[model samples]
Target: MTKQTGGKRWGRKATGESAQVRDGRPRRSRRNTFREDEDLEEQINFSDIKRIGVYLKPYLKQGAVILAAVLSMSAIAVAIPYLTKTMIDTVIPSKDPVKLFTLGGVFLVAIVVYELLLRYRTVAITRVGQLMLKDMRRDLFTHIQTLPFSYFDSRPHGKILIRVVNYVNTLSDTLSSGLINVIADIFTFLLTLIVMFLIDWRLTLWSLVLMPLLVVYVLFLQHFQRRAYQRLSNKQSNLNAYIHESIAGVKTTQTFVREREQFQTFQEQQGQVRKYWMKAVHIQYLMWPGVQNISTITIALIYYLGITGMGGVQVTTGMLIAFVGYANNFWNPIINIGNFYNQLITCSAYLERIFETLDVRPEIEDKPGAVELPPIKGRVDFNDVVFKYEPDGRNILNLVDFHVPAGSTVALVGPTGAGKTTIVNLLSRFYDVSEGSVCVDGYDVRDVTLSSLRRQMGVMLQDTFIFTGNVRENIRYGRLDATDEEIVEAAKAVHAHEFIMELPQGYDTKVEERGSTLSAGQRQLIAFSRVLLADPRILILDEATSSIDTRTEEALQAGLAHLLKGRTSFVIAHRLSTIEHSDQIFYIDHGQIIEHGTHEELLAKKGAYYRLHESQYAMIKTANGEEG
Candidate 1:
């Protein structure tokens, strides 16, 4: 292939670019995108609040204790202000030293008790919130696993990660500190207002006159606050996505010497994040100053009324002082609540994001009465199967029909985008067929529990993934109950034992993430061992040996031939060796099998498979001559 043709083929295959159109029009993506015009308003929903409340239900008994503690703290706060009023009016005015001392002692005792209650409430509330957070994280992760592959394919990995991490962490404050603080502030505000009215109704009215104006201003600030926070959340998610992509593809970036370009891109994303954060800060600054100014004006008005003895009421010094105290208490809670209102507004979007993930129903789930499939006999059949990743997108597999007899090895040969992988995906039931049925052992794969069906099938893909663990542990992942001896035996069978034993720690040698420390050939060998340990009745290898060295390929073919015996296996044919030995060969193109026969039979026909074999052989010979 020419360089341009090869690049185009790889690009279209990797990104599903070839399937991006239907009927000569571009296919619309199903992915959701964040847009500024999309519902920037934050409206409180009772159902969402109620759903969060359910998380607290399991800790209801403990929540009550926390509630009681919070209530007591508020009550004690109210009592302290009254005690000061009494000490100033009754205890001090008459010069009664004994009463003064006694009141002073009582005040000291109240302070100590208040501190104790505050400590209890803080610890109890925090602990409960933490427990609730734990449960929410667990549920979110478990729910993510149940979602269909298409759900993940539609969104960036970083966006999903942000929901699982930053967004969930944001809930911790609301669950623990935010909930209790809001309740406490509300109660304090009401109690202080009552006491103010009792002290002198005239001054009380003066202090509250500007209250509605403050509320209106706060609401105005909150609108901007919510919008600013929404922007910040969007930018933060974008930044996370960029960072994850950059790290994963750093090798490519370095090879192309695009570090400077990537760094500039990083700076641009960071700049966006900073801009949104500053906008939120500016909005908050406007709100807090406005609230404080209104509060100060109210205090000034109360003092003016007290000094003048307004409304024909005598305002004693003690009463005036006590009223001022109540006035401060009254405004303090409003300010606190106003701040918290902004917090809730910001968190509202994050909450919605989290709930959106939880609300997704898996596209392919077990039927209500789906039975657990017994051991599969490996007979696979596809009858007029049609499939599309998106409902409105081009059909990936159109009216495809094929059958693999029990205990047979089938090699699928196709150019890129010929629906080779889609066949295996259907047989495994990763997705349900859009039309007709995929049957394994005479049972529709969709009619069986997903776990029961998948557990009995093993897939070794072109890109082998070795998780972060020891060699032994990675192999044991196929069958968690496998003994160490069995693991080593499987490794030896795949010719992986010699290299593994030479590693720094032998079987216990640490594997880096994605097995980056290992070569391509070594990773494929480890993958082979993983599959062998599973010993499934049906095995699918999609270009599994594509990365192995010529020498290693020779060693693996012996073990693979033995392993393929009496098991239904589908291999996406690339190598001549793999195709030649198959019980049957299928030459597929454009979602149709153009030819099917043994190696000798296909050569005699001199059709599509013949051309493909000739080209591949010529390329190999040219490569060998160049090496020489």
Candidate 2:
């Protein structure tokens, strides 16, 4: 049954080119190309602030405790100044020892209570900050896992790492303590202002005369400060991306003797980081000193008015002292509020990047009411299939049509980039068809849940990935519930048991990431064991034996033949000898199948498949003749 399909593509193509020589200069990695536009300027918006508030909602009880502590602290702050005035104006002059000692004891107690509240507030704020950081990182990581392959393909891994780790950390303090302190500081400012007014309204007005100057200075610095921080963040991400890429490709760099060149590139990126950091730090430093200078002027004005009696209001020594204390209390909160505002500006840069990542909807999410696929007999069909990596890109697969009976072995023979792997990718639903249906057991792959559909298929790519773990554990990854005995059986079937047992600890021997300690042939054997253990209904082997020696390849054929029994399989390989006996052989080129037949039938036809076979046969004979 043929179904015609055409619609907007779900994923965008990455417009990065591979590294190559051009104009006598070695080109950069594709990952670095995408960073060019990543530093676009962005302004913090209300939505970003509102989303941060959502993360804070779960810790409201703790926030309330913090609020109560702040208010109680503020009340004590105001009351202490009044107590000082009472001691000087009334208690000290009374000449009564009882009153004097009683006032001194009360002052000491107030100081102790204030310190205790301050300590509690610090602990509470830290607890809340840490909790919010955990939640933010969890949500970010969870969302990243759901994003389509294209999202990762377009950007460097280091950029994503920084957002999950560094950016989230940058916002934690601002979202928790910074936000709470801003609120507390405002209230404290009001309390101090009111008390000062009651003491001497004239002096209070004088203290606030320098407020306009402070406001103008803050407004002037606001735009430059935020922009500087944003640039710094961009530069930091670029440097991290280069560092990660360098580490991953260190072998290639050393093999090519390009260490000096790589180091030069590293220095250039690091210099950018340092330059932007200095710019941002310079802007941030200006804010504190500017506020402090304004604060100093305000205090000087208050003292001048109170001491000189310039406004003709009589001022007693105790009233003057109490008013001065209130004035300090008022300015301290302003300083705190200014610092919080600076923190808000800095965190806003991080928040924009974090929310931008979280806001991307997964392009390949299950549709509403999608159903789980039941176990299948592995009958697969590609009906008029057409695909493009990009919406407007050239077709990677065009009008391809085929069907495979259940339990049949099919070989896809083609040159590199001739849509061989893409065919299996569609069958596995790693990508959706651009204009056709990929159906297994008559169910379109997209109609089923991803986990249920992919669970029954095993794919081994050209590059085998062996995670960091013991040999036994790595084999068990394919089927987590498999027994140790079953793991050994699978390894033996793939001809991997000999080498595994040869290791110092046998199956318990630990391998580093990517199996760097093992030979390429050994890694391929382990990968084969992993896939075979799963007992998948369908399997795809894309150049699975490319890394193995001729002797090992010959040994693996017998085990592979037994595993392939009663399981539908697709094989892609350059060495045609391995697939000469496949139930069906397809010679695919330029996204189209040029020839299709069994080995003998294609040889009789004397077409593209026959010519390919003859050429490979001649090469082997020539090599043997030369050796003889």
Candidate 3:
């Protein structure tokens, strides 16, 4: 390809081009994709290209149908120009009105058939694309669910959200539209070029001489467009993170009068997005005009050459008309193909971000031979347990040994960041212990299947999470098969039934997102009610009653006394008054259990537990003095 070809292929706005006279030897023609096949040459980003090809598999059938329709339309559409040639050569110069009428009728029928075919083709292909998208989306969601929580903890929530929503949507749209259109354009362009050559090779060669320049223009657009879009994607992720944090902490913002500060930050980011978007649009704006002007000049060349070269032969009006039609049809696809090239480049970053998540291998997964753990005798033991969140973060637990006799209740107490919750997490196997073993009924927790192990231990995390559903539905989330009457019974047992019934729609009232409509204590009650319905043999409650008022706490304490009668339990709470009823108390400090006994025994010993208990007493005394 010549310099003109290179320049046309690489759009004017393309930034990566080396000037023809660079450093030393003439810029060794970069391996032109237009001139070389994959088998004959190498690809710059071969792996990325291959991955893109894999994504196209789901749309292959829809693509085939689209190809057939587009080519059919183009073939017939191109035929009209050729038919005009025939009429000019044989009928128009002869001025046969009968032939004109007959030909006009034929043209009318062709147009009707073409319109109907395209209509059905669009509908059929759209339906197929939608079905494929549905399946892809389902697979993406299911795969994400299986990923370990650590993956999410490492990344910002807004980044994950953008990949899930925007990236997937872009991939789906590209597969459905861009991929189909590009393939059809290639097929039509090639076939039309061949026909034009057969009609008159000299004219065909002269008209497509500008093809090299067209290719250069397209190449330049793809390069800059890629960078522009990638910058825009990063900006979008930042904007998403800001919005997520702002909305999630809306109350905190209002409490501290930081609304204006947040709004200013948001404005700055929004302006950044506009800047990146304009950079991309600027390239696009440069592209169409350049190509249109170049083509318009090419059109003038065609008209000048046609009239001059054919003067002696008395060439008919039909040939001139046909030449004009082909000139118009020829470069439009090049323009379309150029636009698709940019679109393909822009969505590349989106594809990479999305697949990066999908490709992640879970740190821990169920073993091949892992068997379902059957009912156990409710004995638990922690032998030399040691654990931490990260290689560098503070240790949440250290090597130590502890055991609970079958069906006994144990309460864990600690200062903030003392790793009390870490123990619960280990037994639940959310994170495996860094050192030591945790066993239940003689089987190591890690040896058993995750589903079976988790199913057997009921957990109520400190932060109560309730899905957006009706009151009854939220409770039933713990055990999907639970009947409505069973759901009501569980609520009653937990003292949540009375409050639930007072809601406008009773059991059917909708829980707003994050359970926002309900008070914190009310939300806690629903969470416990759900746990009550689950009825696991091993119950581990973390700050379970911290939100309840004195009256509700008394009622719940009474209900829990009856509920904990025969079940094994681990209770962790900050309120010294709450776990005073436990059979044994384990005081945790710096990830190690320092003291263990009944509450009175620990207080009498005047150890770490004694100091913690007295601090709470002092706070109470101060409150009483102020009230007096």
Candidate 4:
């Protein structure tokens, strides 16, 4: 299948190639192996931690409310145990109903206040988390728009989509509540520890005996958990990319009768995801049980010491019960902290992918102090232009120079991959030339802002992209402010109105993405209408009519003449008939212009242009079953 890259098309196969050697050596598929290598090299560094802090910085007010609520809740927790001790030791012994009733009312009020504070904290944390996600997704999407064609060309669309959607979603809970809860858990632990010591230092010290062992286990689990989650993320990304590719080429697969093979490939990719997911989950499951076992052991040991008075300290019934309560409170926070630590490790992997996408600076941004271009007269000049798609790659255009007068049509004819689209792409400044300049009306394209330059140019590609909207809305995409009548007129000018009106709802009929319901000729006509509405001073039609039928092409020729009357047009068409009457024709070959003249002038010389013309005519004759 051929994927559209701005004006150019890149042909790639649906299935991935093997990374194995030709001499029967075994190796992994290139797609899976490449992602694995990338994941293996990833690390969670300090810079990533700092970037996470930046997203959280804006939610300080919300954080403050959540912090206040958590601290208040912790204080109440510590006080409740003391109230129980007071009831057992003093109130009940005095046998005063008033005192007992007063303490009971206080207990009820404390529970109510704690529940209210918990509710407030939940609301505040949720608000901060959702807003942070919104900002991150917005920033990532905006940055993606400014990225150059090369960025999208190099990576699968599914990989990019995962970063913007799934990866950002993975961060929501961790950033919103997980981070603040970790802080709250630490404070809760410290507050409980101080209270436990004040009650009885002997039991407090006994509770801590098993803590070092728990710490050692967590440290051992951390290493394997981090690695497991990282591998799982890589597998998920590979599976996502494969799914996107398969859906896009489902028609081609059906045509080639490869559905069974495609399903097998999907099963293999999904199996990898399942394997890594189980590994990560197994490592996570160990954390809770390990902490729970230690807590149970410590509580039993505290009971034995207090009942037998082994420490030579007097132990009362009320004090023994109160100290046990403090021990549970102290150990519970440690478990919470351990769980938060696991979340931090998992979120770090997602954060790395999100930040990596943001760090890529746009290659085709405006220069410092760039100015908006004034209304152009459409005179274009390519002055000793040199360009290549890659920094170290060979030049696609080498010192190729050309000039076009305002209000003239020039045709570019060349073989496939002969830099025909590169010439037009340079004129639109989709890429900057490695050497020399491409100028419009004596202004260097790079010197003007990209928006201002592109706004004055109309570009229609062979693969016309029709968005999922009504016909009128899609055409109005060319000029957002265009009125309904104006949209109809442009469609009429491009001869698209007749077919559009035939749809169930006329111009208001809804179309699917990429216009699956529309015929190739109909889609091209709508695209042509869109370009006509823009009415750009410089127009580029790259294989604009190649998809349309011969009858439709003939009808469009009249509309094409009207559209090109006062615009400086650059047309690249494979059909020789479309450019036979162009003001000037340049036969491009091997990144160089080998012949240039009008149709008659080039034919008189019997050069490369004449040979191309003769071959095309012969093919036409053969198709009509006529003697050539």
How far does residue 385 in candidate 4 sit from its true spot (Å)?
1.2
lDDT of each: 0.80, 0.84, 0.75, 0.83
| Per-residue accuracy of model 1 over 167-264 as CA lDDT, tens digit each | 88988878887777788889999988888788777777878799889878977777777778777878888788788788989999999999999999
Separate clash counts for every candidate: 0, 0, 15, 0
Sorted on lDDT, best first, the list reads 2, 4, 1, 3
Name the better of 3 and 4 by lDDT: 4
Error of 1 at 453 (Å): 0.5
Candidate 1: residue pairs that collide:
none
Instruction: Find the candidate with the highest lDDT and give its number.
Output: 2
Residue-level lDDT of model 4, residues 1-628, one tens digit each, is 0111222222212122213322243322233331442334334454666787787888888788788888888888888888988999899999999999999999999999999998987888888898989999999999989877766766677777888999999988887788788787788889889988887887788889888899899999988888888888888888888888898899999999999999998998899999999999999999999999999899888889889988765567888888778777888889989988888777777776787678766667699989999999999998877776645556677777888999999999979888889899889888788776889999999899999999999999998999999899999999999999999999988889999999999999999978898998899899989988998999999999999888888888887787799899999999989998899998888777778889899999998989989999999989888642
Models 1 onward score TM values of: 0.92, 0.93, 0.87, 0.92
lDDT of 1: 0.80
Q: lDDT tens string, model 3, 1-628? A: 0010111111111111112321232222121111121111111233444566655577777667777887787787677788878877887667899998888777888788789878866776666656656665666688778766665664556666777777667766565566666766776677777777777677777777787887787777766777677777778777777788789999999999999999998898788889998997897677778778777887787777777874332234667678767777677776677767666776676665555556665555686888788987678889877676554544566675788887788999988888888788788887777767889998898789998888877898778988898998999999999999999988888899999999999999999998999999999999998997888889999998888887898898887787787778999998888889898899988777889999899999999999999999999899889999
Q: Runs in model 4 with CA error above 4 Å?
A: 1-37, 312-314, 626-628
Cα lDDT tens digits, model 2, 232-328, are 8888888888888898999999999999999999898889889999999999999999988888887777677777889865577888888778878
